[model samples]
Target: MKGFAMSTVNIYKEFTDQKVTENVKKVSVIIPNYNYSRFLNERIDSIVHQTYPVHELIILDDCSTDDSRMFIAEKIKTIKDIPIRTVFNETNSGLVFSQWQKGLKEVTGDYFWIAEADDSCDPHFLETLMKPFDDEKVVLSYCDAARIDDDNNVIRENCQDLYNMFDSRHWDKAFVTEGSEEIKKYLSVLNTILNVSGVVWKNIPGLHDIFEEAKNFKVAGDWYIYTKVLEKGSLAFSPKCLNYYRKHTDSVTSSVHCDIEYKEIVSIEEMVAQKYELDMETYRWQRIRRSYMDANVSPEVKKKKIAWVIPYPGKGSGGHRTIIQNVNALIRHGYECDIYSEDDHRTTDEQAAQKIDEFYETCAAFVYVGANPRAEYELCFVTGWQTLEMVRKIPAKQYGYFIQDYEPWFFPMGNEYLIIEDSYRRGYSPITIGRWLANKMETEFHTPAQYFDFCADTKIYHPIEEIEKEDAVCYVWQPEKPRRGSELAFRALKILKAVRPQTKIYLYGSAVDAPVPFEAEKLGIISVQECNELYNKCAAGLCMSASNPSRIPFEMMAAGLPVVELYRENNLFDLPEEGVLLAESSPESIAAALLEVLDNKEMASSMRAFGPQFMKDLPLEKGFAQFIRSVDHLVLHTEYEQPKAEQIYTRAPYKAADEFRAQALDILYTDEVSSTDAAPAVPSLPRRALRKLRRIAGRGVRMIRQRIGKQ
Candidate 1:
């Protein structure tokens, strides 16, 4: 959208209207206090005034130096309806889960709610939560709780808002799903059950053992407990916000990134996956969880000023859009970023900034058209293959590459290829956009590299309702860029047209080519909004790349469009099978795969449903967080290990030797020209040089493959 504005989600409303006295049985309330004296009185009263009867109330004070113990003692004397018991520990238990275990041991009832001393809930909180335990299989039940401050002002409307990264329709309403399903679908990624103050658990057998295991984790113990406890039975949720989870501003913004806490989080995630035999998406959800964690961390030191030496970009290039998006992300983190473009633009700073705002995002980056920097930068990052040399020439304390692709693959097996490969051997640190690139750098180039997850801006690319569906395929047709497989797509679309002429082909993301060899509509250079519209209406999307996968497939899937791409090593690590079909690298194979999506209604519907679901876990903001952390480590000189990216795909890459031999000749030559025929017309050269260097590559199939094999 030209005038895109981040939509404000104001889900806050006073839900003080509903009342239900639906009672099941005795519910034990545990109040664990430390130094929360001011909130203790309110916390005690919220538990005491529960609409559902409390069989017993246990108050455990962990050596509070404040007036918490005095407030607890005062409240204990006034309690009449519930059996009140108070225990004041002489020494503070190092772990909160220790307090949890002690309180659970003292519970006389079969159900317990651990109400943190700092939190306060509504009068009907217990009654509403207790209603779900009517099913014996329901081991856990919780409701949406809004965030509050010490003044009782709601800071956040609902905890469900945290789940927007993975799911939008869930946790907003009541649900009764199997505990295993909840763990696999929701909790396995990160802790979907956010705050423990909102949950009520049934005291099933072996619950204490889980609690004992939770004691091993200091920060994520509550999250561990939730995953473990859900193994006992089913889960029940209520959307009503009768619980108020308190948050002190000092505690939130003052929080620092704790490495131990993160280790525990991933460790528990691995544990849950192994226990359930779940198909792990490789920390996809944790990217979202880290955003929640990173949001809280207030870096004390200012970030080093950065200069992203970018190539002068055309209006809607995906590469340029990604660079601008990252610049915007850094700006939000208080880093001053400058864009130093080549003099090709021949524009002033104001014009450069205006053009960026027009073409890409509304960037806050200081845009300068020339390579000479007016101001010094602590770090200079290169955004493309063309900028690496320029960035190296620039004076900076640090130089790094924000590589989107193995640029060498964009060229043939010649000087251009060697030049791009040599760029990797440079001393500058590199951060790639996806794991496969990282894998290449680390395994081949032997440089430890970090890569951010490939994700789409879900808010911008998601499915738009009321769009009429069409039997069309939207091809990511970039002609000038040879890696985009212009010739391959032309042949494939021709094959598809011959088989199913009714199927329409829409070419986009590039300028109009002199007339492709098939029946297709050339809708080049569309807006972000228009791209999403194409994604929504089209049955399938084609982004034929022989190098690092572009952001197109992710965007297509984000808009609920099934995608088709070449089956290659570069895509195997990042592209999810649910959203994309990795067709064999041949025109016939590509056409047949496209046909499957167009003709098979069951498969298409399944793909459409799964694409959005897969992307919901990998929204753009999540990718931003991962990138920020990667750079933060670089700038702050922090020690971190980049996770080794491996392929989730098990299927072998399909080899098409005959098709390759023929296509290699097809690309370099024309059909047999007779003596009467003039020289073969040369209009458009190959788009993105084919990574055809494989069986068709050593400069020309067996040669390139032989060289690659030798290397």
Candidate 2:
């Protein structure tokens, strides 16, 4: 806090743009006090202890209820070098501008500074700010200020509100611009100069008239008065934060909405536009600035865009689809969403966006080929494990993970898995798809996590009463996706076909045709409407997951198709058993669970009745609202109540059958099945488990594949 003021080193600088001149300027300092006794002594010290001395100092106490008058009298006694006066008002002036009017009557210097009693400035504030007056056109000179607390700790080094309005980065450096230019661009945009304590104004004739006219309105009088002052001459600004503006916890205008403020803001906008003859572009921006005046409405945070870094998506990629869906949701809620794609396939941004619109839902996000965007985002989301590195290179105020799955399971327990784990260790407050992924992040990685529910588009994947049910089953078998458990699901379908040979089988959700041992129809890459029809036709659908359960099962249940998934912690925390069945990881268990749903009509009827009922509460809109609330937390720089992770799936998975209980048997043994009909999924289920178990046990599964390939 000390030794960093401009006077700590040297106050003088060589000026090339403007002529450098030395002058004896008479500077008057005014401390307008009202119930700020705690800070009065320090405020007086800051003004009197300046590197450049003041010509006169006047401390005006506006009948403060606190002991400010006593303090002001005591403070005046210590100021021996400068001529100082203490004026105690008979009545408390209700407005700050009234105090400014009262103090201006006592000012005898050529330049006057209305230093608020709650704020303090550096020793070189006078020396630095007074120099700009050497140019006769400079009427008011102000330097950048640090926001400080009553305890004098710096909240922020430089006030960023100066740039937030027009994003004019003049606060980053020193400049002297025309006063009318200031009024048109900045003052019209709602007081971009911010604090008056940072300003030293030349005590020009008729300045009192500006304050008297300005004080007619409350809440925006400072802004209006600045415009009036700047109209007289040029405005000078130094970027060095030499002034400290104290913000109190109990500020009246801090969180309250005032109709006077809103109305006056609109009035000023119109007045400035017409007075300066501002072009339509500046006038349009001035109108947009009125939204910030509504305190009850959402803050400027909603105006900031959220950026996403995602892997280059393929057609029919559900992960990328979910990312785009939420991006569109945000856009609908008044946030700009820019999606950066990491595509090594040399895909153009247009091509990638076209593919997204073609395969996934239509998105309103701006799609870019690389991670770098032109503007820095307020919050950037790294959409997956693959794009974490790419998102790191982006410029953002905060970075987070848009986690859909427990991505470590997407790969084997090796290099990529370890890197994904480290990505979570980067301590991103991840916004997950469901409670299970959020719970995993909070418990395992110890990061703050937020979740939106796994909602199916009920209107699309809904019941079609015309389609009659068949003694059939469908499997989501995407071989390219490791988390889908394609091999496990494929084996389960084989056993189901073996048990009841009359059962029709179908596989979908993949574009590339691959060979399967079982008898089934491959309806490769069905549309959403076609998927709804398929879900209605089948009695059961198998959607297996080794990680967080996919939304496919939810959609199936919504369409009255009872779904079966592997019983794991990932599934147990989020998936409900009403329309979904959780089975142990084996061919026998999955086949048995599918059979259980098909065989029991009473249970199937209950699932059909409740699946959509449950989905009613978990619509895409509800999930989107929750996501928006979590993201708004980032935007407002405030944390909502951090709730403990609660488990939704309270019941354990259905018990594994007692048909195959030989713990000491070798899991590495690979048994060959001659045909789907030849292999009975009966008491020989123990032998049926051998091949899948070998795959789980590792090397033997690959060896058996090698042997089959040779044959």
- In the range 157-219, model 1's lDDT, one tens digit per residue, is 777667777766887679898998888877876777767888998988897888899888878
114: Cα error in model 1, Å: 47
Write down the TM-score of every candidate: 0.52, 0.54
lDDT of 2 by residue, 1-711 (tens): 333443222212211223213576888989998999998877887777677767899888888999888877776777777998888889988888888998999999999898999888877787889888989999999988888776766667777764766766767789999999878767776677779999999999888899999888887888888888888899999988888888787667533345556667767876775576554335435435644554444444225768889888887788887888788777655566778889676789888777777878767676788865756788899888889788887888998789888888878789999998989988677898888888888788888788888898877877889888888898887998878888777666666666676889988999867666567888899898999999899988889888787889888888888888888988876788777888877665677788888889998888887787878777777778888888888876666654555766666675434442112112112243424344422222345555454344333334544543443
Off by over 4 Å in 2: 1-302, 660-711
Judged by TM-score, which candidate is best? 2
Model 2 is weakest, by summed lDDT over 10 consecutive residues, at 660-669
